[model samples]
Target chain A: GAGVSQSPSNKVTEKGKDVELRCDPISGHTALYWYRQRLGQGLEFLIYFQGNSAPDKSGLPSDRFSAERTGESVSTLTIQRTQQEDSAVYLCASSFSVFSTYEQYFGPGTRLTVT
Target chain B: AQTVTQSQPEMSVQEAETVTLSCTYDTSENNYYLFWYKQPPSRQMILVIRQEAYKQQNATENRFSVNFQKAAKSFSLKISDSQLGDTAMYFCASTLQGAQKLVFGQGTRLTINP
Candidate 1:
């Protein structure tokens, strides 16, 4: 079975630039999540989608951060006017359902660098 | 809000020896799930083991096992016969029974020495 996959494994952008990170969840997965991991830090919850709708967006750091999922398959995280503080690894995960019993499979992640 | 903590920032163990990583969490929810995830230098997060808060028995996966203390709010991972492949950053996470979000602890970097 295919695991969750993310695009643009590595990205370097100047401050104030905008970037988009993509994620492809496993087939049939209805739940998708996004997280941010700063260097040597723990994972910070971002946003999650159950099907194509997002139920939790409180984790978004600010208005510049947003995410969307379409067709209940692929998701995109967009950071507008990125700041150096936004530099980190963006991770994507997917699960069969929203239940806690189900394990979320993670993707390799996209390492975003803001210069 | 739920919070997870990893007291140890780093640890090391000789190959074929045993090592233990400690984790604690604070949550008001009674029903939840606990997990241990490993991330290697490649930056791939892998599920090591999981424990259900409602279960009394600890969860074990071959050489990896967890001592889950629900009363003390402690969940520790024990690796026996540690291998070099086990060298990585270990994170402890938890989520409510019906919740979709997880609260993760500061990772513990485990180094396996030969």
Candidate 2:
């Protein structure tokens, strides 16, 4: 079975620029999530989508960060006016469902460097 | 708010030996799930093991196992017969029942030596 996949394994951008990270979840997955991981740090939750319900944006650090998932397939995380502080690895994960028992399969991640 | 803590920043184990990584969490929620995820140099998070808060019996998967202590809010992962391929960063995470988001701990880097 195909696992989760992310595009632009590495991205370098200038401060204040906007970047979009893409994620393709495994087939049939109904839940997708985005997280950020700074160097040598833990993962920080960004946003989550379950089916067609309103995405959970509670973890979005600021309004500049947003994500959208079309139906139950692909998800894109957009960071508008990116700051140097936003430099980190953006990870995407998906599970069969939103249940706690279901394990989320992660992507390779996109390392965004804001210079 | 739920929080996870991994005390050890790094650890090492010889091949065929056993090693245990400690993890603790803080949360008022009674029912939740605990997980251990391994991230190799390739940077993909892989599920190592998982434990349900309500389950009294610990969870074990082949050479990987977990010691779940609900009262202490502790979940430790024990790897037996560690292999070189086991070298990676291990993260402890927790999520409330029916929740889609996971709270993760600062990972512990485990190196398996031959």
Candidate 3:
């Protein structure tokens, strides 16, 4: 089976521009997550969606970061007015459910460089 | 708040040797899950192993095993007969039961030389 997939493996944009990163989870995965990995840093949780429940946006660093997911399919993370600090590898992960026992499968990630 | 810590920033060992990566965590929740994820040069995060806080017995997956110490709040991953393919960044993470997000550590870079 295909694992999670992220589009635009690499993206470069101006500091003041806006960028949208896409993620396609496994066929039946009901939970999806987004995380940011700064250079030489660990993964930082951004947001996640579980089935029909409300998405958890607490991890969003600022109001400029937002994400949307319809049902259990695809998810898009949009960054408005990107800053140089926003440059990092954005990763997406998914699991069968939100249970801790279910392992999360990760995508290759999209590296965003804000110039 | 929950926090995970990986003390060793880097580790190196010869192929077929044994290496252990240390991780410590602090959390208020009594029941949680600990995980070890490996990120290769390709930047794909792979699950290495996982341990439940309530399980006193360590978790093992072939050459990959974990030393879970609930009282001490420590979870260490031991890779026996390490192979070159095991070289990657190992991240220790924890999350509450049924939680949506995982708290990760700084990660340890493990290099297996042939």
Candidate 4:
């Protein structure tokens, strides 16, 4: 089976620009998550969607960061007015549901660079 | 809220040798799950093993095993007969039962030397 896939494997943008990263979860997955991994750091949870509704958005760093999932399949993370601080690898993961027992399958992450 | 910590930032072991990576977590919830994930240079996160809070027996997958100490809140991963392919960043994560988000630890980079 195909694993979670993210589009635009690499992106370079100037500061103050906006960018959108896309994620395609597994066929039947109902839960999707977004995380940010800065260089030499751990994964930081950003937001998650359970069947198109985000139940936890507490991890979003600021108002400039937002994510949305539609049809319970594909998700998009948007960063408005990108800052150099936003530069990092954006990872997407999906699982069968929100259950802790289920394993989350991750994608090859899209590396975003802000200059 | 849940918090995970990996005391060791890096580890190196000779091929075919045994190695262990330590991880500790703090959480108020009694029912939860613990996981170990490996991220290679390709930046792909792969599930190495998982342990359920209620399960006393450690989880093992071939050469990878976890010593889960529920009472101490410590979950350590042991890799027996380490292989060069095992070289990567290992992260420990925990989440409450029925929770959607996971709290991750600062990864430990493991290197398998020949």
Residue A33's lDDT in candidate 3? 98
Error of model 4, residue A10, in angstroms: 0.7
Off by over 4 Å in 1: none
Interface RMSD of each: 0.6, 0.6, 0.7, 0.6
lDDT of each: 0.95, 0.96, 0.96, 0.94
lDDT of 2 at B77: 97
The parts of candidate 3 lying over 4 Å away from their true place are none
TM-score of chain A of each: 0.97, 0.99, 0.99, 0.97
Q: What is the lDDT of residue A98 in candidate 2?
A: 89
Per-candidate TM vs. native? 0.98, 0.98, 0.98, 0.98
Q: What is the lDDT of residue B30 in candidate 1?
A: 92
Docking class of 2: high
Encode model 3's per-residue lDDT on A1-115: one tens digit a residue.
9999999999999999999999999999999999999988899999999999999999999999999999999999999999999999999999999888899999999999999
Question: Per-residue lDDT for A1-115 in model 1, tens only?
Answer: 8889999999999999999999999999999999999999999999999975645898999999999888687999999999999999999999999888899999999999999
lDDT of 4 at A85: 98
- TM-score, A chain, model 3: 0.99
**Per-residue alpha-carbon lDDT of candidate 2 for residues A1-115, written as tens digits (9 for 90 to 100):** 9999999999999999999999999999999999999999999999999999999899999999999999999999999999999999999999999888899999999999999
lDDT of 3 by residue, B74-102 (tens): 99999999999999999999999978798
Once superposed on the true structure, which residue ranges of model 2 sit more than 4 Å away at CA?
none
